[model samples]
Target: MSATLGCFFLSMWLMRRRETVYGWFAVMSVAWWICGYNQVATSPWPFRSTDGWEIANTVSLLVYSASFTVFILRFCDGR
Candidate 1:
């Protein structure tokens, strides 16, 4: 959890610097926090299954992949 918070703040700082990659960092941090919240302590009152965390983790991966793909394309195109 602390690690996630650290990354989240780092990403925020990067975003403040206007780094495009930090957009993905921010998205992944949010997803990571959602996933991590499921395991650290008591479950929230509404959630019954771990499915939501799994989905959040999966979404994080997808966002990462999509961002990498876009970054690569832009780099190759000199954009």
Candidate 2:
């Protein structure tokens, strides 16, 4: 996760040079991922499953989905 976040921030920093909306979206995604991941960690699950990891996983998924959605929208707009 740290590596992933690190790469994303690196990309964002690069984007800052070009100054695209992707840079802002990256910031938003990172913020949401961090906040949601923490919430997931404190959540309770009843059964023993790899899915026992809820908070971080859910947050990660949502962040991925949101990022993908943005990518799609940008692609559709011929970005």
Candidate 3:
């Protein structure tokens, strides 16, 4: 976990990404990775679980989904 966290922070620093919507895409991916890690750690047992981790993971995925959809539409359509 420490190594993962260290790599994440190091990558962020090395990236130095701008504050554009594209940057938000990277953020979304990172957020999803972290939240998904949490889900894996918790094992997501039982359908009765209603933790915030699930919500976060869902939201992060949604950001990526929407962004990728937009990218496909604009880039593919040449518009």
lDDT (CA) per prediction: 0.58, 0.59, 0.55
lDDT of 3 by residue, 32-73 (tens): 565566645755544346675577668767875775565455
List the candidate numbers ranked by lDDT, top first: 2, 1, 3
Give lDDT: candidate 3, residue 77.
55
TM-score of every model?
0.43, 0.39, 0.41
Off by over 4 Å in 3: 1-50, 77-79
Q: Give lDDT tens digits, candidate 2, residues 1-79.
A: 6446646765976957564445545655664665555555544444355465655567667776766676566546744
CA error at residue 5 for candidate 3, angstroms:
17
**Any residue pairs clashing in model 1, and if so which?**
none
Q: How much does candidate 2 score in TM-score?
A: 0.39
Candidate maximizing TM-score:
1
List the pairs of residues colliding in candidate 3.
none
- Model 3 scores what on Cα lDDT? 0.55
